[model samples]
Target: MDSFKHMHEWRQNIDRFFGESFWNEFDSILKPNIPQINIYRKDYEILCVINIPGIQQIKQIRCEIDGYHLRLQGEIELPAKGYELIQEEIIQGSFNRAIELPYRCREDKVHARYEHGLVFVKLYKDVHDSNKSKTISIEEGEQ
Candidate 1:
């Protein structure tokens, strides 16, 4: 049909204009490329739990919170002498994950703990009032 051909041509033109990036982003958002996260909502706070295995050391991971987004960037080094794997599905290499957090966290109260090869970060809901105020002790003639 001529109408079907016109629709196909229009679709191709749109795709050509946007390139593959538009589709890729749409795919990423439609079906996120990361592991699933579980949200536990209590009366006062929202908790996000991610199952990140094989990640050790809280210091090795970098966490940054900006507005509603929280990002975690880190590396998990594989063992040097693991037997030649025929089939490997475990995800390796450095991963950078950006998660949109449901609630604001206290920037100073964000804490991380590692146990059983999993890294867990607890973000508190309330920002500490003390963190907002900066005390500058001006020493006489120190400048």
Candidate 2:
């Protein structure tokens, strides 16, 4: 009987230390990675396929290209109103994902489309003279 009392006290201590919000934090950490992406590079274009479920409209996602990087920002929402949640494994929230490209992409030639819970982004490579040099201006700091 004494050992049972000690075990109960230990469980209470652990519960107090973890609190009620611990599962929320744990769920965020343990949930699957959102907006999983796959990139493919061809000779002059790059194709990026992203998995983003629960998007209601295409306007909910924003895609951008910066130099050799592709940025995706969006929110995924699941309609769960007036219903009890027995279990929650799907992640639904705002996400911002940045992916590095193998080469610089042209900003003006970028194309993006969303379909069937997936986002497809196609970017054209920026073909420029890499050997060209430009002058840099330097400003003196406190010496």
Candidate 3:
């Protein structure tokens, strides 16, 4: 029938408008999230496992803690040089990622290690005195 032929043509036109090349261009424009991380909470400490490949040295990564947040900054470099890139799926660039912790961590008790292209960070929780109270002094001020 003519109606079925027209429907097929419409579908083909729509598919040609948004084809594989369009999606490939879109993927190139949007960068994927690099250095994926996983966090685990234990009784007294938090463990963070981060995937950071293509790092040549441990000094390429830096970790910092602020309040209840952990910040990781690093650069990933490809081990091979002087080679043409035919296809690229792994991302290689400088990245900064921040992770929110469940509780405040002690700055002095934190430790991190890099092995087998993965960084393991251990953060010890800070003990707080919940029952401690402070007396407030009231002062009169102008309106």
Candidate 4:
């Protein structure tokens, strides 16, 4: 109860001090995690859909699967051979995005295919035994 009041007062003070403009300026420094993801879960497996447009080479992308999360890091390099630039708006550098997978995926069984500038990665996960839980018998001994 006391903690809630303190938290409320703290939030009100922060809101009064910074307002909206201060928050916008602070948001400009840190890029928000943005991605178009569609997830589907079936009885057998889960499907994850991602759209990574404006990418040149699929080989430049690095993907890693850890537990139930997928870590993706890559850079979209600017194209050198092309027409002269009139208005350059798109940024060129490095970017990384992570997605929490519904299930664990096998590393070697993962397959990736690129077509029409879209990458489709197929991951296979070995089903685990979901029927057991560790139970520790505790006995309190007087010290």
Query: How would you encode candidate 2's per-residue C-alpha lDDT over 19-96 as one tens digit per residue?
Result: 856657666467756778899988898988888888766667777777777777889888888999888766678988
lDDT (CA) for every model shown? 0.57, 0.72, 0.73, 0.57
Q: Please, what are the lDDT tens digits per residue for candidate 4 over residues 1-143?
A: 69999998887888899884665766535654433456677774655555555665656666665546666666755666677867854544676777787776555455555554444555566465232222111111221
Candidate 3: segments with Cα more than 4 A from true spot: 1-29, 129-143
Show pairs that collide, candidate 2. none
lDDT tens digits, residues 45-92, model 3? 999888888776666787777657788888878877889988987778
> Considering summed lDDT, which 10 consecutive residues are worst modelled in model 2?
134-143
Q: Sort all candidates by lDDT, best to worst.
A: 3, 2, 4, 1
Off by over 4 Å in 1: 1-18, 25-36, 80-82, 126-143
TM-score, predicted candidate 2 vs. hidden true structure: 0.63
RMSD of 1: 11.2
TM-score sort, best first: 3, 2, 1, 4
